[model samples]
Target chain A: MHTETPFKTHFNAEQAGLESLNIKSSNITFVSVSDMLALINQYGVEQLMLGMVEYLEADFKRWLDFDKSPRFAAHSAEGVIELMPVADHQQFSFKYVNGHPKNTKIGLQTVTAFGVLSDVASGYPLMLSEMTILTALRTAATSAMMAKYLAPKQSKTLAMIGCGAQSEFQILAFKAILGVTHVRLYDIEPNATKKCFNNLQSYSKENDLNIEICHSSEEVIKEADIITTCTADKRNATILKSDMVGEGVHINAIGGDCPGKTELDAALLNRSDVFVEYEPQTRIEGDIQQLPSDSKVTEMYQVILGEKSGRTHDAQLTIFDGVGFALEDYSALRFIFELIKQNKEAQQIELLASPEDPRNLFGLTQTHSTPSA
Target chain B: MHTETPFKTHFNAEQAGLESLNIKSSNITFVSVSDMLALINQYGVEQLMLGMVEYLEADFKRWLDFDKSPRFAAHSAEGVIELMPVADHQQFSFKYVNGHPKNTKIGLQTVTAFGVLSDVASGYPLMLSEMTILTALRTAATSAMMAKYLAPKQSKTLAMIGCGAQSEFQILAFKAILGVTHVRLYDIEPNATKKCFNNLQSYSKENDLNIEICHSSEEVIKEADIITTCTADKRNATILKSDMVGEGVHINAIGGDCPGKTELDAALLNRSDVFVEYEPQTRIEGDIQQLPSDSKVTEMYQVILGEKSGRTHDAQLTIFDGVGFALEDYSALRFIFELIKQNKEAQQIELLASPEDPRNLFGLTQTHSTPSA
Candidate 1:
């Protein structure tokens, strides 16, 4: 199957589709930030959260069947840029993400991302979607997925320790998947809390959920069923100390990703039961970085696969230390790729060149009409 | 700066180009296989070889400035797919390549590749290019550059082993750079010999180059000044025995690039002075795989910088065991990306959707005609 076209064979490289079965142009489906807000509004965050949870459960069950590779990371003084790649026998997906903590200083979000979904056989990229919004949606959905399997039944209150762009997504996901009716929010910046408070007011009315912005992280974490810290600082910030974290309080640590950029105090990690996406990667990138090399933390796959206990007791402090996995982005890309493929409103952009003669790709320059994916 | 546009911007993703800077939009350039063939015929192979060598040499000298990430690879029962990433402070490039020997049975090239050049600052893919044909060109050009620094000054003839798609480029590169006038070819398949012979018949007139089809490998090895093994077999064939190798011959070993794939005898490595692209990678991928880990080998950069010897003795056999490096692709991409930019053939590809309102990504679906970054 790996022969160069006999120069004369009508095997145009540009015309090759993602399927590789025949040459069809690729359709790059794009989702901008604004479109994402509209999508969330139309379906409602509750429905989006539910959709994501179901997708993650299905994707995780087939984890071993997929082709997984270590992410490609470029380290800078300020942050890191990474490309995470994953594929099964058919679909290939990769996410481009950056963790520049200084971005907020310049009026930009701390992280931004986009992704591609392609066919493994043809190697044609089928979708190029903006993933900044999708990432927020998926991360929240992942947290809720963990809560469904591990959190105590009838969990209803959540203490959100850092209310930012991702905080609302987290709140909505919990409300949708875990039936958390109330959220107590806290942020370093007072305006950030106001923004979360004002933005979530409409969501509160629609879902009949209650949200209160708190003055301190300690006050929010005092008596909640779940605690989520999504701080964006580059330095090691102890947003949640051991004393603040109570029993049976699931800690959804979101921001402590890179080395030396942890959020939770090491004291809390020692007392809590930890779960990670991928052990090898999480060891270097998750809140588990605070723990020893030989620390006994279960891979989330084990929990998903039912090989290990998630919450041993109703009073255990369970920490879902998520440091985003390639697999989650893999599932998200496929979900959106399939979503847009079925919907007529999802516009298709031509990104790959599919010519009549793969060998005669030079003839495209002579044409007046521009081709899309 | 990352704000999404109120309108949409578009471009092809898989077409070829490299990272280019612009204040407004991301400029992406492309070169398909036919365009390369067109350029090859128009400029002639000599000029393309010369330009590639000049560009490759420039990038090789500034090697320390690059942020080099080791290539990520995924192996399978049938073949392997690898992602090679490298970047200087200004430009970044990555190539996706797959090696499957059995692919020939289905009429596909054993190795097929495409790549993107992106800007580090904005996180935009500026160019996507077809690298299959360009890979052949760069591989040949890299060989020529090696011979220029390593080969004997009075080299006249080259032994062509395992004549394939790469055979023509290698021969032409040698002719253009080393003034090699004669090539004696050998391949196990008679059909391959016929293909190589027929392809280069047109080049014979321009340079008065002589090509002889030989019956055995020994026949070609005895008289040639350089020997290039561009074979496709995945096994350790030991095509060139230690005893058959002559003195002062510069061996360009290109085909024995993966683990378990080698063309040279182990004894030949002990007898010949071995030089590699990157020692860490070559240890696992090159002909030196036959040798022990501690066995000393010089880096090509050291030889280029004159910190180590290339050919210390007239009688010593010198080998350039090249498993293609990311730097070569970086240089090749820079050259092509610049070419399209200068010729005004490149266009801005809207890859990342940076909206006016970073928080409103969900509103993009309703505004289909809206512009974004």
Candidate 2:
């Protein structure tokens, strides 16, 4: 007899939960935003980011393992809500993410998200966790991961155009992973800049990095080592124009991720060595949306796989048109799940009912039942 | 002054202390199979069905009020999982559902589900509820509502193939609205037939009707006034061949709602008057998949909106080829929300976290401090 409980009967947010509930029961797991943030803080942002990068790379390597689509987006005046679903043989995941730049006005984050990880075999949800914070971590890490491949080895200074909720993470990630030392920040709202400045002041001390607050996009981007534009809103706002570009500046375009939304000018994309997380998605949602059909852009995975060069040269302008991918979510989730495992401090929330007999679904109400022969 | 809550907070099965926590907080309401059954029995199936029917009509009449897509489905060897999303001005709703026939032998229901309802403008989740029981109610109510419009004036003698979990609800719903006095059951598994027979026998007394169990699919199909094929599986099995169908039959083809999974044959679809919940989705998932691009299938909404005819004569063969719609789930959530409002017996689950200042997302974990300007 086996000493270990058959994971088949044991239902936790275990790694095996995906295979069992996905194929075996109508089981679903739920993790909310508060719990997710707690998990992130417990895990330490460095490990979380690194883990996400690794998982993202693994998924991208087996790119053929996924059943993917470009994502279905419903756009509004303030922002957009998108559904990104991708699946492989054993597992499937989809994200419900909203990008409302104006949500902060009413005391809400610009992006609020959640996701489901289900079994490809049974289609039962194995886990559900808050992706809002995870999305930020993953998005920032993904950008940093790309910059690691595409930016100069000694890159130190970073210019941030959008100093909102995402600004702190983007700067910190680059500093942690890319050896970035100095960060220059700019935002349309001075209060947003002040918030980012204060947040980064503490983060900089913890990470041992120097930071500066700038008044204009030109001031931030002028002779920058690497530039990151994470501006919000559903507009074709060109915070970074080609005219202001300096040589060898790697652009991490993070905010413009839906149709009719972009942070860079068309001329800038035409002039840079453009790379994307998912080419199909980027063509519609990334900075490439401003470019022509014949414009060339490399898929980021190719660079990661070593099939192609990243920046190619120190003097080249490398643009990582980051439009947030499902792989990033998968990586972030795997990281969080691992953190939850290592630190048993995080509360385990339950959202699925384990039926005594899965088939007698109606018996869920009945406390006692006799199974018919 | 208005005092009612403007938003509905959502909780998952795991958070509500259910079996699984594989869901994120957002526009998703994850009801474990157990939660759904609990809601159904507590609210009583009759109240739920009637409530859903009322919402269905309201939604259907304001048909253009939704951001509707036919549906997007992904099929695998074990089964199929589908994403059905719809949005109105005020709210948006989507359901994640799957069908796997082999699940029962391994200990699982053939279908399992969870859904999300959100505010379209705010991009925030209003409510999340277990929809498995609600799905059963909505599915049956949708069929009954369609029968009210499409079936002959006096519809009785409903023959149900595959008398599993769904058949009980289907029979009861038809009995309630369509005055379906006669029901004949058939399933490959005699246990399923016995279960359905026993369940409906008890139900018929309350509804004032009669229920019968038959061994052969063809015998029941031949005499049935309304033939309902609710078989569970992936293979393209023909529960009723064209030869078995009678002239005046209203066929509710519920089982065939996936790409590789179907029940009624191509010949049956061609000979009968086919009506679908959504034409584009039905063309791919319904028995109509066996038909051609030019296949003339009528939208059920058209008949309801008076743009198309239902049954012109008693002898006309009618088929309500329902593959479940987002609008139906929309109606289900709406019905449940209304039910919880009217009846104090409804249980309230906590799914979302309240942070005083959303920007201090990190402060959610620490002692509260006023956000600095």
Candidate 3:
């Protein structure tokens, strides 16, 4: 068993009495990619997603308490880099993420991210975690949590239109949260579908879940209770046409989250009862960007809070146009912070400056005598 | 001499042949407070600030190339946390900073910060650094750099009001960049003034710089060539009355930042020729916030580019109302990135995820077989 590292020891000491210990010992818990994988191994991916859904649902219910804004994005010729920040009364969190579709050609992930969680009172960061994997987890958890209130009851089949990096996570989240046992996958590249199918072999057998591969999106969603479109095109390419989506199917559109990027046909969006993570942001980056500015759409928080209707009838078409909100990242960071508290050996990094005398910041430089000529 | 760690090795290998190397080996250069102190000790604070001034001047000249926006702020009862992001065509940078005045009461610094520098082409972060110390350095360097263009020629004395954490850095920056040899300090708390005076003893002695402490802000500014106000009060209290300021003095007013927090009297602001960094932001957060929204003020970049006048004559009252722009942080991070390249032993952290197959993100969890019950 791993001994209590300074990360946990300091946290425990602080919890005992924040004023007793030297605040200099307060360091940020750092969750690397390897740490995240270790965590997933410690608790299965399905269980983590199940845990995350509760957080997502709880945070969404109190959405009005959060300070929300559209992400700050710096778009270049290649892609975009964005900073998403949201905070409640006690804690503040922000995620630094980037999207470059062309990165995979050079053997890099299309989207990579990291984030910080901080205390609102003292303004000191509590944790810094690798968010690429966590983002995939949270995105899926959010989708499945939304579908719990919006999808058909006991939804058993999910059709994933983009069988890329996010396909497996989406399938597992639906399985863990909504009892989705059948997954149908399709992609523009057949290799993506093959990879998705190959990855799920062991889990599918163990959990008694059925998996199938289809050559076309139309064929994939033929009887799917829920359809997920997550293609990575940087332009307004309609991967799902209005005629392809069947009645009463909840569409989970996750990709097409940038200004010029979208996945669903505008006509399909017009016909469905659209729900979004945050209206101001989704108006610019979500599939609703293709619709008129004044088009009718419901913010998902209202549905979660029981202020608005989610699934009015079995025949009503519901579409979740999630552009990804900052509040979800805040909840994910908050959840991970709690998990690390229980796991003693989580890594910590010296990310902040803690001078013995807080006001004498200049004294830190005088510690070493030798100065370079 | 320390050996080349995996950080520099991977960076070099990527530079030599980006397409040939596995991009998974790339990691972010992590500069802790200790690392920053090591850097300051190695090169000396004066030399580092001098080098930073050159970068600041060069960047300010080409300011139009940057994608700039007002910082995103989350304000609470205790304080505010802000994300300041700016990017050029090739590089992107942002700083995460918070200011809680009451933090010092609990033995925490009033302000703490960290930031990320990234490649705009790939949207991958290149470096992550502790900005608490660097922010002090950058803030001083920006003030002195502006004083170079705006201050009266060959000024010798600097009077600093509120001799707290930033006092010593401001004094050194003036000494190194503008050749100021005399200093006068005053603070509301006499102990803060004593602390500042004690900290600067060795540097003053070594460089033959004269130092004085005054009981009142009025006495401190007497015959001063430059006056700097940097009190940390969170309210609009006038530390400098208009009648107290004299002509031919360059005023560096930095404490009067944020919406309701200010230090200079409105009459003093009305009497001075104010120059600022990034006008849109200054209009909300700088000392100029006391003035009307349409009040005339010069953006400093234009002066650096020689498009506008700086100091017209010796008797003119000029003020650099700097609220700390994102561009300065960009320049500071860029400078540190270059410095760490020469110092091979700089620390690195695994802040980003790099799966072997970018599309097979699910495969990462499979590396460890046993799942918790």
DockQ of each model vs. true complex? 0.14, 0.28, 0.49
Chain A agreement with the truth for model 3, given as TM-score: 0.93
Going through the candidates in order, what fraction of the true interface contacts does each contain?
0.05, 0.26, 0.70
Whose lDDT is higher: candidate 1's or candidate 3's? 3
- Order the numbered candidates by lDDT, best leading: 3, 1, 2
Candidate 1, DockQ to 2 decimals? 0.14
Assign candidate 1 its CAPRI class.
incorrect
Answer with 1 or 3, whichever has the higher DockQ.
Answer: 3
At residue A316, give the lDDT of candidate 2.
Answer: 94
| lDDT tens digits by residue: candidate 3, A236-328 | 998999988779889999997999999999999999999999999999999999989999999988999999999999988999998999999
Candidate 1 C-alpha RMSD relative to the actual structure: 8.6
Write model 1 residue lDDT over B1-373, tens digit each, in one string: 1122121111223222233355223124445444444455545556666777766776676777778655776666677777788876656788877776765555445666667776555444566666766787789989989988788877889899988767888888898888888988988988777777776776677569999999888887777889998898888989899999878889999999998999999999898889888888898889999999998798888778778888886787988999999989987776666555654543444444454334333333224343232
Q: Which stretches of candidate 2 lie over 4 Å from their true place?
A: A1-28, A342-357, A365-373, B1-35, B342-373
Question: For model 2, how does the per-residue alpha-carbon lDDT over A164-251 read when each residue is reduced to its tens digit?
Answer: 6677778767876787888888998887788778765766787778788889988988667889998877779988888899788899
Provide C-alpha RMSD values for all models, in order. Answer: 8.6, 7.2, 5.4
Model 1, A66-134: lDDT tens per residue?
776557787766667788888777667788787766655544445777777755554555666667778
- TM-score: which candidate is best? 3
